[model samples]
Target: MNNSKNESVGCIVNECKFHSMGENYCTLNKIQVTKHETTAKDVQCTDCGSFVKR
Candidate 1:
């Protein structure tokens, strides 16, 4: 896992493979973000494409 202090990848999904245990953060070096809809109406329309099931 990356311990870089400069990175601020915060996450709450404990089921994700890249989610840091007990840290509420993502350990992936980078994440791919994508829109779930052609026209996003709210934050719920966004999705983290880098998510992998643990």
Candidate 2:
């Protein structure tokens, strides 16, 4: 994965492969957001679908 950060996207998940190296940002131009439940009611119900384990 590219270590370069995408200014438009901010990410803090260090475990994710898309997370910018050494920064709270994303390397991809865009990311996919998914909901764990049929109707998301809070932040916990949502997830970054683009996340990949490093």
Candidate 3:
């Protein structure tokens, strides 16, 4: 696992493989934001497509 965190990417999902070790950030240089709903209502309607089970 890459413990190096991308300062620009803020994340709190500890279960994600790209999540920074011991920090609330993402290790990936970039991430995919996917929309699951027809209308962009709120945060819950979107997902981090780059997420991988740790």
lDDT of 1 by residue, 1-54 (tens): 564321478899889888888778888888889998999899999999999899
Q: Which ten residues in a row have the lowest lDDT in candidate 1?
A: 1-10
List candidate 1 stretches off by more than 4 Å. 1-7
lDDT of 3 by residue, 1-54 (tens): 456999999999999999897989999988999999999799999999999999
Q: In order, what lDDT does every prediction score? A: 0.81, 0.89, 0.91
Q: 1-54 in candidate 2: lDDT tens per residue?
A: 566999899988989888887879999887899999999999999999999998
Judge candidate 1 at residue 37 and give its lDDT: 91
Q: Show where candidate 3 strays beyond 4 Å.
A: 1-3
User: Which pairs of residues have clashing backbones in candidate 1?
Assistant: none
lDDT of 1 at 34: 92
TM-score each candidate. Answer: 0.80, 0.86, 0.85
Strongest candidate by lDDT: 3
Instruction: Please identify which of the two predictions, 2 or 3, would achieve the higher TM-score against the true structure.
Output: 2
Question: In candidate 1, how many Å is residue 23 off?
Answer: 0.7
Model 2 stretches with alpha carbons more than 4 Å out: none
